[model samples]
Target: MNKLKLSGILAVIALFAMASCTQKKESNSPKNLQIDNKILAQNLAQKFIITDGHIDLPYHLKSMGFLDLKNTPTLVDGIKGDFDFPRAKKGGLDAPFMSIFIPPALQKTGGSKELADSLINMVEHITTSFPNHFGLASSPNDVIKNFKSGKISLPMGMENGSPIEGDINNVKYFFDRGIRYITLTHGKVNEICDSSYDPVRTWNGLSPFGKEVVLEMNKQGIMVDVSHISDSTFYQVMELTDVPCIASHSSVRKFTPGFERNMSDDMIKLLAKKNGVIQINFGSSFLTYKYEKRLKERDSLKRIFMKENNLTGKDSLAKAFNTKWLEENKLYADVEIVADHIDHVVKLTGIDHVGLGSDYDGVGNSLPTGLKDVSGYPNLLEELLNRGYSEEDIEKICYKNVFRVWNAVLDHAGKNN
Candidate 1:
């Protein structure tokens, strides 16, 4: 063969060899797992102990105006709400903190304690009504034990501190009642701390009584949740808390600029420094700035529509109008956006400080597209897999990080008490 012809033949052989190697590598990648993403996601979900930092099941049930725990649609099918037994099982969610949410109005009406107690009763009623399916998890050990027995763990976290009724001893009272975490305030300023949503700046950080509450909480082993409090309150709590803290159902503020409801990059870094965790909120508003604006506009329009039509919220006409408006201006985000928030946390801190806290049922109908309910967790796992996260890292994101914080709180309590 001529020299030029021989060189061309050699290059063709090399190209063929390279293509074969590339094909082999592709087949062996994590993307080539058996079956579809749904199955792979299911497998991962089952393989790990998935713990969500917050869920508003108690409030959701209360909003329905009644409770028949065993016979309720929530324990059965739960097509309306974001969480239920069937969906939780399918998603492999082992532990979800049942939010004992106290509305801010209750503070003025003087029933915050009573309302909080009722919700706590409702949570206990679930395990009493269906012993085999669900059980109460008061600690990290309890969660693991429940997971082993193939049952979902219902841990409780109070959404607002108003239930404490300004008494520091109520912190221990709640801790004894299976309340594992407490969001200092809700959407309004309170005695403990100011809320991110409230204009009043209240105590600036923590009130003298709020400082006592923080110490009592830490000594009692309750996780100080910085989800709904103002930025100043978060820093103050971090300063006061001896044990690791958690932003139970919050997303990074980087995505939604000026949204104090979400944690800023500085706060995230500081949280990680305290060995704390920021469980990413899956709500559309928490994930993107653009969607937040759209949600506001939609709400404003809905208000106008209600007034123009003389439709009270109780009227069917108002419900229909609100439904139609949501359908017309759907600003749903993709599940991948949630993964992006996780990525942001992981990049700023590490895999050890990020976890899932979907804010399910609490965000109402504002859930993201692919992650509309409890069953959509696998979609999130599939996204993480696509992003090249290893099984160990995924496990850390699933539960280990939060478990560490939970255990740390317990340990701190042991010493402090």
Candidate 2:
């Protein structure tokens, strides 16, 4: 009860209050908060097993004539493509469905099946050449096993169904070869279905044989990818498929209006209703209309310049002019635009029906600014975090959504068998 003791106790309490206030100020500082988010984003990127629905690495290599095992090391170290072993690891991409993109021309030239086989063989060769870094994944369980062993899973998806070669049995053949999904058509109408880009509408939808192909796919447990198919074809497949399907790398048409290559609002809604997922494509043209408009303007200007200078497209002068123009007028969507596509999907359908299907090497150089390669996934994760997405939401968007559809397809096939 002494005056000196009371004064001493009051001073100690004031010091404790001051220290607590200082701690609160530092923790809430903008810079400190930003740093915390960045760290959290990076940690999440590594914590979850990221699975991209589509990546065109197999065809990219075939086009470059680098399918031989001698060039296998480039897949781990080369910077020529958006996906490589090192970049995928940095981005936390555990399973990227390697697109076995068979061109439509091969359907008429009489070598579609052979070409598909060759590409599949090349993928097999890569895994054989570098067993420590890459593993062939035939199922979701395989992907998880590869991830646990610190290896990237190379699951395959055929970009065009041309490789089916008009034989219903070919569907099972591809499934046996590790082809999990088959995009019915690409750039042109084929026996199975019409393409979004082909105005001919040859069959007006799925051909008579195409219906059989769909049922065969369902029986064989292969996903039917509706990416480049015509609207009629898409509807037909949706009706025919018994199991949930996926649009492996298509964006919503809300941004690019009238671009049939992207799915419409109605299509997305129907897809979600059927328990399917539409993986968002990260290409700038797919994300926004601005990219296409700018691209057209640049091309028009380049054509005028070449005509004025009497330079052909093959001429070095024309090429130089095009490059310079593009540099000055960069036509690209940023990471935020990509997130907008994701947001639109989440709002239209719940978060369960949307996932990442960045058409990495397939999109050429038109990827969003910060997401230029496979290593930019953390940038995307950070954007989602900033938008108030919970960790559980991020996990579903990362892989669980697609895996649910995948496992459903497998289960359907098993039950039928």
Candidate 3:
């Protein structure tokens, strides 16, 4: 009786263990989810608002010496640029913040404000020219309406606060002109704040005037972009800002160590605490240190070759050599690398604090492979989906998080006014 009873008990325990193991394995298995991630990604892209925090459409147009977007041949069809009407439509991109970039050179010399105004005008003209295909989005509600109408929304974000000059009132002025966010500085320290790229940490953070600009931005319902600012500037802005700030197009600094342009782990955590969002940049240099090193090496070699050949930039020899160099040194981190940045943010914080801000049209030729242009968004969405992200999380990444910060800024401004 003892041997029979013991054997029966052992068999039952073994059966229970097998069932538990199977359940545990299936829970962790991506394949067991029985979902076609590709289709899910595509569907989610189409169904959601897909608001990228920054896109350099206005700057791209300005570079062409053409203020026109609809009549611009390159935008009508895909050119060497990373964003265009056709590509955005194909990618299901509904809302993209058209970056009004003011070159830092214009800061000391002045004219930044005028240039910013002109770029904003160009964006408005694009909407007027292609009314059926494009519309201006001044708020989150406008984006939703544009989405309903099957039109792409072109919201504006100024890439440099140089446009504001030293005038605190100009912050509200730009916001009135539909400039929703302002990157306080660019490659150089300005009157507003110290830049990450500049060696001179003039103010050590935000200048006295910069703090005024931040307050005005908050009062006027404009997001304070911290992508190009110094770590001190970021920290100071974080402390001073009443509303959530955004690194409109930055990657995880953990992936690219010492890259001040990317947010650090602690910065990300602090940002999440403030209910802010970090939109992942898809540039190869921003994604991984290894890729960034390769890019630097390639540039160094290219410069050496140019010098050795005595080829000036305008010469045919220089052009040919530059072409050859680009072709040979075109190193792209895959779309997975970009997805990894998104995953890193989500892991550190929650999915609520992360979103897409590809820096498209702004990254030059360093865009990650399979994410070459606006049309490449589905590739990223698919990667996130396959990595076990649900549609809800993807939607948040696409637009909800962006809207949350945007609305918060607006709401904060409303209360102050």
Best of the candidates, lDDT: 2
Error of 3 at 91 (Å): 0.9
lDDT of 1 by residue, 1-417 (tens): 999999999999999999999998888766565345557678999888899988888888877765445444448545468888899888888999999999999888899988888888888988887788899999989989999998899999999999999878889999999999999999999888899999899799788998999889899999999999999998988888888999999999999989999999999999999999999998888999989787788788878988898888899988887678778876877898999999999999888999999989888777888888888888899888777798899999999999999999988899978
TM-score, prediction 3: 0.86
- Candidate 3, clashing residue pairs? none
Using TM-score, give the best candidate's number. 2
**Predicted candidate 2 versus true structure: per-residue lDDT over 50-156, tens digit per residue:** 99989988888877877664665457775588999898888899999999998888888878898889889999998998899999998899988998999999999
Tens digits of per-residue lDDT, candidate 3, 1-417, equal: 699999999999999999999999887577744356767777877888898888987777778767644455445556668888788887889999999999999987889999998899998887887788889999999999999999999999999999888888888899889999999999999999999999999999999999999998999999999999999999999999999988899889998889898999999999999999999888888998888677678778767887998877788876787677668765778998988888889999999999888889898888888988998888888898778788889889999998999999999999999
Model 1: lowest-lDDT 10 consecutive positions: 65-74
RMSD of 2: 2.8
RMSD of 1: 3.8
| Candidate 1 Cα errors over 4 Å, as ranges | 1-22, 25-38, 67-74, 77-79, 296-330
Clashing pairs in 1: none
For all candidates in order, the CA lDDT equals 0.88, 0.90, 0.88
Q: Candidate 1 lDDT (Cα, whole model)?
A: 0.88
**lDDT for position 189 in model 1:** 91
Error of 2 at 251 (Å): 0.4
For each candidate, what TM-score against the reference? 0.88, 0.92, 0.86
Model 2: which residue pairs collide? none
